[model samples]
Target chain A: MLPLSVPFIATAVLSVLGYVVARKRALSVAGGDIRTLTSLPHQHGLNTALSTLLPPLAVMMVWAIGARIAARSDVALVPENPTMVYIILIGLAVTGFVLSLLRISTSFRARTASEGWIMGLLIFASTIAVLTTVGIVLSMVSETLNFFGQYDFRDFFFSTTWSPNFRGDSDLGIIPLIWGTLYISFIALVFAVPVGLFAAVYLSEYAGPRLRSVAKPLIEILAGIPTIVYGLFALVTVGPLLRDYFAEPMGLGQSASSVMTAGLVMGIMLIPFVSSLSDDIINAVPQAMRDGSLGLGATKSETIRKVVVPAALPGIVGAVLLAASRAIGETMIVVLGAGAAARLSLNPFEAMTTVTVKIVSQLTGDTDFGSPETLVAFALGLTLFVITLGLNVMALFIVRRYREQYE
Target chain B: MTDYKISAKGVQVYYGDNHAIKDVDVQIEDKTVTAFIGPSGCGKSTFLRTLNRMNDTIDICRVEGDIRIDGEDIYDPAVDPVQLRAKVGMVFQKPNPFPKSIYDNVAYGPKIHGLARNKSDLDEIVEKSLRKAALWNEAKDRLDAPGTGLSGGQQQRLCIARAIATAPEVLLMDEPCSALDPIATAQVEELIDELRQSYSVVIVTHSMQQAARVSQKTAFFHLGNLVEYGETDKIFTNPEDPRTESYISGRIG
Candidate 1:
């Protein structure tokens, strides 16, 4: 059996015990009437659970780190087969933690301990989640810093060449990847925004009840389809069709794996995202506004073009931004459809690679942690995170402003 | 020939299977204020909407028989509802100003109909329409402010201004005073009376006193049918129909 960490096991035990005690105390205080308590007994129990678990979890983490460091120091004295010795020490430490948990569980009244124990456990659980995110950010930042130490920051930012193989000399600049990402996303947006907005306008304003019921669900089903399925379709169906029909006949390119191929597939993936959001924002435009416009002799389309869209402009912008973010972060379609050769070109017929593709390539299969190649993935990840976060923040701001205007 | 601006004959309206308005016939004279007074769901608003074809917006709503503005059959296949509405404008029950500047709100219809050739002409029409609605003096300084920023009464007047900017021959008002305070209602009522000097006005009102105050002619609807329609003085004091007397007395609405 895989041994569990001692602190995690102890936290679970203390939390349960603390909860029982807190519940009993709260119920007794309420004269055994559960409803008489200010809050639900479960909330009181949770408060106690969080208090109990947090303190011991913090102590355990510090102890575990110190123990590992001391073990490494002791292994340094042995001078012979340090790696094997370190692995053995880690195994011993894990076993000791499991044994400690087993001993703690066997004790009596363990299910009715202090209320602080339950509160501690809850707090510890939340901290674990928050700390995990912080840990990921720190790890990515540190590795990215290491990558920047080797490659010039200016070259990474501005240079448009990206051929990164572990030969004696390899160029690894980020601009080509950024360009590919932006180009595919731009193509996707161009295809999505108008079609989606029109569909949204039609569905919200023009469609009768029967048509709306059928069309709205059908559009949502587009979003429900798996991204990998889209990837496969792009690879097998669209790729060959483009090659035979357009590329070969026009003499645009020799190969099927092209930016246009991936972009078209990505655009199809983003249609429902744009449509659904645009539908919601359009629906949010008050009925009174439509009535007012229509009442004034404006036809339905004219009303939509003049008043409805303008009223919902900020919301539409927010929807497009959200869709743009989704398009940028899309990975599988680009991975399968767009060939991984990060060449900066305006031609959609040419093959391109994105930051996501590079990150995937760097991390997959056998990866050497010490190498600059693997570390570069961390930098790409950080960049992807920042880009998506900025897009989301801007979308939120626009949506909020739109709502404030109406309210 | 009768100096009528709008005429309806055997007009029946249905929302899905439910008949909202029964067979109703009414004639509105040129440059006169006509009031439709009835209880809620008695189809006063529905009948008012039929004049401008505003009911076309509702997918479930269906209108049968004839409604004409200036002798032109509004429901005819060749007759564009947009153009018909351009000639016979409407103001809704609630104050629904577009989320636009006051000038733009008034200029919207004129711009859509291409009534103005240039900016100065559009400005002149806007100022004239606003003045006619009796809102120009209050809103003169803030023509650029959002129409929605105005008070409830001012917003209704702004809507009236918006309607008049198109220079429509007839204006249909479905409870223009419903959302306003007494002072605002009085102002709108006064404006409605003054509007009779130029445009034929059809107003749907819930208050008997308001119909008496603003309208020259009043039509009383009961259930979904027009029970009585005549001069405002005759309907209020000595009505021919028993339903009209009961409605006016507040016995049955």
Candidate 2:
């Protein structure tokens, strides 16, 4: 078949040609009195261009997807002759161009017609966004179902041990990974929530204009640093530092890569997520509220703690929950700082592995697609998806309820 | 009790080099309704804020000279603004009730001041303040409802109740009736008249008629200067200054 660029270039050239031809046709039909036409010349041109590209692009996309599906089947890779598909695609483009060229008339409202097509394009773009999420969930669910078919659902979910082996009958219990995900996320939140909240309160309330302007973006710069960089910081710096100074000396595990190390680094990474959003929420509690409290004999700190903070509590809870969801989905920092040991231990300083790390490990490298090990990644992914989805919904509900309180 | 509840001597207020309130003097008397009448931007509100040190909140605002309330200098470094504010209560134009129960809104000041040693005492203070604000009968049944749930007039009265819960020696109302309807304005005027018996009530009003109706003594301020200060009857009938007469007759603002 012709390369993808061939059809793209052909469509672009044809669209430009269609624009010029249709504009000239419209002007001529208007008898050089542009006001006589129902729609302007530019509208006629845009309508022709949209019509010119639509047919060929749609045909090419459909043919590409059909060929991909056909190639996946137990048949030859050519999939019903790629040459015929290219010819038909080009044929449709030419037919669309010729039809549009004949349709540009003086009385026609090309503006309204083209606007309808643009609106359709916008709706289609939004549909693609929603369909992508649906597609991801479907793919994961199918694989997870296959995984449960091969392995007992109870053992996969409820069993405490997680031992994946090349020998087929691996103890694929998700409990250990689930525990590690929660434990690390808990520690991350415990470290993050208070520090982030205090920073938000101080910045939004106490910091003067000049100080706030300088400090706010500087704190947000921490968020701009990618999580992968945080992983490296965790790996090379924080892990060894914690092991030598805190963990090993306190009779905890001697491993450089432990749950404590990963949790602390991840917590630092999540500070901006909490503080920026909480700052906005705190700032939204009206200036009148602060004045009322202060006018009633309450000091600045008392006003903030008793009045402003209480008014902003619902939004702060929502922000904390969103941060919690992010902490659960975090992968890079855990893989580097938390060692790959799926042990069910009470100690936080011991090496542990999370669901995300195991999902990456099981999916990477050469492995049979039919094996339960590879399919378990989908199960882990679906569980994580469900958890984060639950958290997001709760946050949205709380924020919505908070809005109605003031409005 | 002293004849003058609050006295300002050559008070000058500057907001970042812009002289908002020029050097002026006025004496507000005890157990009387004193009204500051002026056009917009005439520094009536700024001068009222100086009494309670509310001007301290604005970083650019600077108050010079001395303002004595009940024989004590409020701006002295030793005086805590919080304690002074409790002694001198303020009600704003907009009804800003805390997003809490009506009872809690009134009890807020008393609780912070440790005025009530027990829950029943706090409850008594809230009731008495609401009663003084003429909101007791209406709000007594639903004291647990959010203060913000009240109507605009009721909310303004709730704020007044909240302000008086601390049992202040002086109460300052900055255009308290400006946002109310005609009926609500009448009700608040009557409340202000009653408030004069217990606390020295200082009100800043834009309406000349309101000053004539509610004030015992009226101070007409023009362009940051006290144009005329006398009994409300004489100020309305025959003002001393031309600017005061023009402002009263609706000539120049």
Candidate 3:
């Protein structure tokens, strides 16, 4: 890993050089009358500085990655594993590129030169981001295809069996895992939707300005609390509470690690997410609708129920879908709260497993590279990615349609 | 007069420290159009909103004294403002149409009050309301389309239709033609004339010409006080107040 000092130094040097060169060019273009320029001279300076720094930094990243790969192969051949040497070399490459950018900046200008280089660098940076996403998808797809070649596709999808042991005999059907995930998520949604939506409506429509000021920040603070903290809260506090109150009383399985426990905790974790999103969309509904309803002699609550809520329906649907996606992809709460048993059962008090939990289990600790158990995590990840992507696309379409109605 | 539909007795309104409406009293005659003409900040609209209890929506506003609708005190604690508003509807300065189908927009009030027993009753109410607003022919084919998709004039008429669907005994219009073009204004003025035959109509306007053309009685307000109130022809031709004369002659707004 490159020391963090490099990029900062490079950026600082490039910024100064960019300022000087941009000023000189601007002054010359305006026949020494600086006031004639349309924009501030500093904006031009920023533009030039960005151009100088971006290209070299990109090239340095590629060079460092290539060096590491080459070193990995060479280290494999050597008697001693030269991991430190590879790291040092990669670090040097990054430092050198950063220093080079620092030394040569936009101040070092040729009068004949155009801004083609800057544009190219910007395009190159953006393409790298797109290429990285595509690369991840491609890598996941290829690995998943390899896993399917060993396991039947129908069995992987439809079969309820999912015992992926590294021992000679192993079954890795994903149905039970998918079922557990959907069940837990469904429970979470049931808890989240009403409470979140009610809180949102209260905050947006009914709360006085002072109460809203206090309540909104308090809710946002829930969002700021890390998921890991929520997981621990679920595991230590809520889990036992549920086992005592719900599971034991109902004559269900008396375990703290139940789907019900995890789901309820996860719902609490997602309250801020749902409330914040729903609040924004509800606020976006024009005040005119409220006034119109009120003018027609409707009570405030009646106006909200009849006019505001209906107008904000599409956006609220979008918010719910997004919350559903968050609940599905959440890993820490389920891992810490729900037990590691992959069973398809209707009983909420029973221990259940989710896809994210299985992914963590499969990846962590030592394991044989060629085993199907190891590869299943990648397949699970690919499926999760696809599901979230589909939901987001649908949400975007709905939100766009809702916005077009008013605009 | 015994024919008066609404009577205000020493009604006063205050916004925080600013007294928005001074001690003012007026009686609106039944089944006639009464126009209140004044410049901006003259409290013409404020006085009009008092009849339907619309000012109660504002948090800091306080209304003092009595306002009676058909000889019943509307401000009585036992009386519900919702029911009062249903009987006395209002149209705002700008055209505010609900984001619903044109038919649904007109049908909303009737549906809320349970006035229609069936689909046919609702259809009848919608048709009659639209026809009364003089918007039926233009909007007859597109009843299912969104109400906001109409032209400005049509949207204003749609709001008028929505107001009339509740079968209000009195209609309060706050500068109904201010946002509309001249032709739309003319259409609305004609509709106002037609409407006065059935329901008491009160309009707050800045146009003296509109007051002359449509109203049976005209009240001129200046700086939150009623300066003159009489028959429209007499107020326009021979006013007793100097402020009214200055305003009518365009010497003062």
The true-versus-predicted C-alpha distance at residue A80 of model 3, in Å, is: 23
For model 2, report DockQ: 0.63
Q: Rank the candidates by TM-score, best first.
A: 2, 3, 1
lDDT by residue (A280-389, candidate 1, tens digit) is 98898888888888877888888999999999998999999999998898888998888888889887877887889888887887767667777778888899889988
Q: Which candidate, 1 or 2, has the higher TM-score? A: 2
Which wins on DockQ, candidate 1 or candidate 2?
Answer: 2
RMSD of each: 6.7, 3.0, 5.4
The DockQ figures for the candidates are 0.55, 0.63, 0.54
Residue pair clashes in candidate 2: none
Report lDDT (CA) for all predictions.
Answer: 0.82, 0.89, 0.83
Task: Check candidate 3 and list the clashing pairs.
Answer: none
**Per-residue lDDT for A136-173 in model 2, tens only?**
99778988999999989999889999999967779999
For model 1, the superposed segments whose C-alpha errors exceed 4 Å read A1-133
Best by DockQ: 2
Candidate 3: list runs displaced more than 4 Å.
A1-15, A18-48, A58-132
